[model samples]
Target: MKKQEQDHQKKNPIYQEYQLNLNLYNKGKTQLGIEFLI
Candidate 1:
């Protein structure tokens, strides 16, 4: 059941988009942190 859900997530467009946005948010956070440190 867990495996099936993971496979479904892999195929889900919304889930994929959320993941992309999450990655971008993390990268932006890192850049902001570096600017604050400098």
Candidate 2:
């Protein structure tokens, strides 16, 4: 079940966006990273 969920996220756009967000979050500021959710 967990693996299936992980695989689903791998192909999901929202998840991809979240990954971009996490990258930005890890890079520096919080404001721009939060904006990715919207």
Candidate 3:
């Protein structure tokens, strides 16, 4: 049941967008660190 829910979320486009937004926000916070992380 837990695995099924996790899989569903992974397939969700909204989830991917949210992840991207978080990453972008992180980059905005630390432009220099983001260069190394990416």
Candidate 4:
């Protein structure tokens, strides 16, 4: 079922790492944008 797949993703270390990287990338982008605006 779809719920089982979601659970599997939650347990996956690679996926977790990818998500953390994605968050950092987004934060970096936001900071760059603010610097450009100011």
Candidate 5:
């Protein structure tokens, strides 16, 4: 995930778009984790 995100950042240096995608990715990860925990 870290490696993929790094590659994505390099592909898209636009801070706003990168941040948005990162936020969404993080939220998805959180949801998955919660489901796994449950």
Candidate 6:
């Protein structure tokens, strides 16, 4: 399941967008774990 999620994130733009948002969130407030939820 985890591997599939990783592969999906690599191929899907929506996932990539979420990843960017995750990065920004991590940078701004350091929650750091939101990327996985996204």
Q: Highest lDDT among the candidates is held by which one?
A: 1
Q: Which digits, one per residue and each the tens of the lDDT, describe model 4 over residues 1-38?
A: 69998899899999989999999999999999999999
lDDT of 1 by residue, 1-38 (tens): 69999999999999999999999999999999999999
lDDT of 1 at 29: 100
Q: Give lDDT tens digits, candidate 2, residues 5-38.
A: 9899889999899999889878766666778767
User: Clashes in model 3: which pairs?
Assistant: none
Model 2 regions lying over 4 Å from their true place: 30-38
Clashing pairs in 4: none
Which is the better candidate, 4 or 6, if ranked by TM-score?
4
Q: Give the poorly placed runs of model 1, Cα more than 4 Å off.
A: none
1-38: candidate 5 lDDT, tens digit per residue: 59998787678759668788899999999999999999
Who is ahead in lDDT, 4 or 5?
4
Per-residue lDDT of 22 in model 4: 99
Clashes of 1: 0
For model 1, which pairs clash? none
The global C-alpha lDDT for each of the candidates, from Candidate 1 onward, is 0.97, 0.85, 0.90, 0.96, 0.87, 0.81
Per-residue accuracy of model 3 over 1-38 as CA lDDT, tens digit each: 69998899889999989989999998788997778799
Q: In model 6, what are the clashing residue pairs, if there are any?
A: none
Which stretches of candidate 3 lie above 4 Å from their native place? 1-5, 32-38
lDDT of 5 at 36: 100
Q: On a 0 to 1 TM-score scale, where does candidate 2 land against the true structure?
A: 0.48
lDDT of 4 at 1: 64
True-structure lDDT of candidate 6: 0.81
